[model samples]
Target: MPLTLPLAELEVGKHLYWQLGNLKIHGQVFLSSWVVIGALLALVVVGTRKLERDPRGTQNLLEFVWDYIRDLSREQIGEKAYRDWMPFIGTLFLFIFVSNWGGALVPWKLIHLPSGELGAPTADINTTIALALLVSLAYFYAGLSRKGLRYFEYYVEPTPIMLPFKIVEDFTKPLSLSFRLFGNILADELVVAVLAFLVPLIVPLPAMFLGLFTSAIQALIFATLAAYYIGEAVHEEHH
Candidate 1:
């Protein structure tokens, strides 16, 4: 009998082939991050198309998520800023929460595709980096919109001596955000793989449950920090 590895351990480079040309796309393109993002956007659009004052079914579920995210924003960023940032914050939370859970629940190993496995979009580093960039840009735009030219003044605030450290701090936010998510999800996936490999029967069950908890916590942490960054960007300094 050959050694069988879990889907989590499978590498795309070995299972999928890519053509090298100006217009050539990889065989795994369908399973790529863009496809997942498109699917998420489509769901959001379809769910919102037939809105009702009294929501039901998918609409109710969407509304529930929205309310949860709104509450999170209000608590973390305050009411005045929460309304303005709700859509961005809400979208981030929904996308991450869905992606994390979906990845764990989906039977990527059972499906045979060009890609090695059909894991969640959030499992990809590119996807996480893109999300972090969006968060960084959101805060940048919020800061600019709120403070105009004064946004630049934030760096030199308290004292000119703190300028260099403040500048570095600003630059590190996105990097930290991107890596924190990527590292946690990757580790979770790896643990799942190792456990499944060593004991295929029932040993991996506990780890799966733990992974779900960790995934939710990571998503919440990411969204909370994002809200905090946006709040910091737009907050007025006390004299």
Candidate 2:
């Protein structure tokens, strides 16, 4: 017998929506992404306001995260560029990390809208692609800023003989980054959805735990690669 896969029909407007009109203040609408961004912004604001020298509560937790990312940057990119890249890397890690895990905890199903409901922003292709683009832009800018006109030299590295390969390698970075994140998040969502359908209860508990782990790892990988790209863009030829 052929195995039958469960198909859930997700109506575009019901699960996702976009508004178009002159009356719209925002050009494109994405409630899920907006909510994720809003939550991150709120965390930043509250964390900063609550900062204490002798850290306690949320301040202590934020400091721990900051320290962890700072160390990660130093390990992957080295101390020279780590300081400059810390803020961006730290923000990326925390934002993506939170967004991924938050998807599991948020009462998305409990709250009903005209559309289906909110899912993890990072789980969406558009959101992951946007992140990849941002990372690309960051490293491109870093290259230009660090090496001036010579930044293009990376595309012709080893020798002019190797230009084609170098260019191909450079171009693949963003594509790999985008797809890796998209694939992992998409897989996690699918697993959760399928398990919820088939087992519906006790069986999904293990999958949920696994999903949480996968989510954190995906965030870390993205941030690590981002830091690595920035490091390569700025590093001296010998280093």
Candidate 3:
């Protein structure tokens, strides 16, 4: 008898489609996203249920995360404006962190879908683009609301020659942000999947651990960049 290995079946670009009138959506992505959202909401609820000067258990963890996020926003957006944007930045970080970790840690493969498999929402193009677009809108709103009509001056303040590039940047910013997160997450998932298929045992453990670390890092990176963008928009240019 000859020994043979089963071929790994990788699923890519496959979406569990849902149709609503003229609109089409990815059901799997939304399903996973809801799971992530539910997890976050549960943690928040439990953590805030009992407020105390001396935190314990889930409250302590929540407070640590909150303080860390606050510090990050303050460092990027400055103390004057960080408080206003802390919620937005913190939500982004927590959502992404949970999504990434859940994708890796959850036994999503056990749940069989008709089309696409369940995974991290961030790994999807639509989700990342939506998040990136939100960041873009946040900065634009921050700038226009804070500076009024004078916000347009940012396009040419450094020099008139910089106007064109600055205008182009508005488009590039969201594009880069969306693609960066989407590519990194999707690539990570694919890499881990391929490794698991090839080894099917002890070999994939290291890759799984590394994926967890990168997932957390990506969440931090996305949140930091979002805060930085908002900070730049609201920054007071000293002449």
Candidate 4:
């Protein structure tokens, strides 16, 4: 007799491919991402459509979320610079938070694909790396734009001896950021799938709950770090 594994085992590393002219892309990631984006936009639209002195329903929720993201940015990026970058930071947080939770909670497996099934966009290495690279670009742009040529002086701040490490940090920042999010999300999904495969019922519930919690935390951490990086770049040095 041959042993067979159940579908509950889950496909860990597969992607739905779409050909766009000559370039191939992950279809499922985009599909799920679009869903998340649409949901976020709809929420924003509905929430802001009617603004009142006394917030109600979705408006109240929206205001609370806005305040939370604002505070996070203000605390990390400072009052002067935080306002300029709050939208970017908030978008990152909301997008990642939705992607992570949606991937975990939604029954994506119900919607089958030719190759890969739908999951969190963040679970994909390409998506996380792209986001990480964007953050890297943002900080560099922020520094140079705000400080002009003086931004290069950051490499030597505290002491010229720090130049080598600062240069290396530029490379490490994105690498660390991308891998951290990617690894955590991938691990969480895999853990839940494996537990489901083994027990097929009640056992996976706890892991699923924990995954949701971690998902939210990861979003917050990513946003906070992004804001902090920008703040550090634009921070003034006093004589």
* Candidate number with greatest lDDT: 3
Q: Name the weakest run of 10 consecutive residues (lDDT summed) in model 1.
A: 24-33
How many residue pairs clash in all the candidates, one count each?
A: 0, 1, 0, 0
TM-score of each: 0.83, 0.86, 0.95, 0.96
Off by over 4 Å in 2: 1-6, 9-15, 22-29
Inter-residue clash pairs, candidate 4? none
Candidate 3 segments exceeding 4 Å error = 1-8
Candidate 2 global TM-score: 0.86
Ranked by TM-score, the better of candidates 2 and 4 is 4
- Predicted candidate 2 versus true structure: per-residue lDDT over 149-239, tens digit per residue: 8888786666788888877866788889888887887688778867887878899889989999999999999999999998888877864
lDDT of 3: 0.92
All models: lDDT? 0.78, 0.77, 0.92, 0.91
**Top TM-score: which candidate number?**
4
Residue 181 error for model 4, in Å? 0.4
Q: Which residue pairs collide in model 3, if any?
A: none
User: What lDDT score is found at residue 66 in candidate 4?
Assistant: 96
The per-residue C-alpha lDDT of model 2 at residue 222 equals: 97
Model 2 error, position 192 (Å): 0.9
Report how far residue 116 has shifted in candidate 3, in Å: 0.8
Tens-digit lDDT track for model 4 on 9-55?
47767778899999999999999999999989999999999899999
- Candidate 4 local lDDT, residue 169: 94
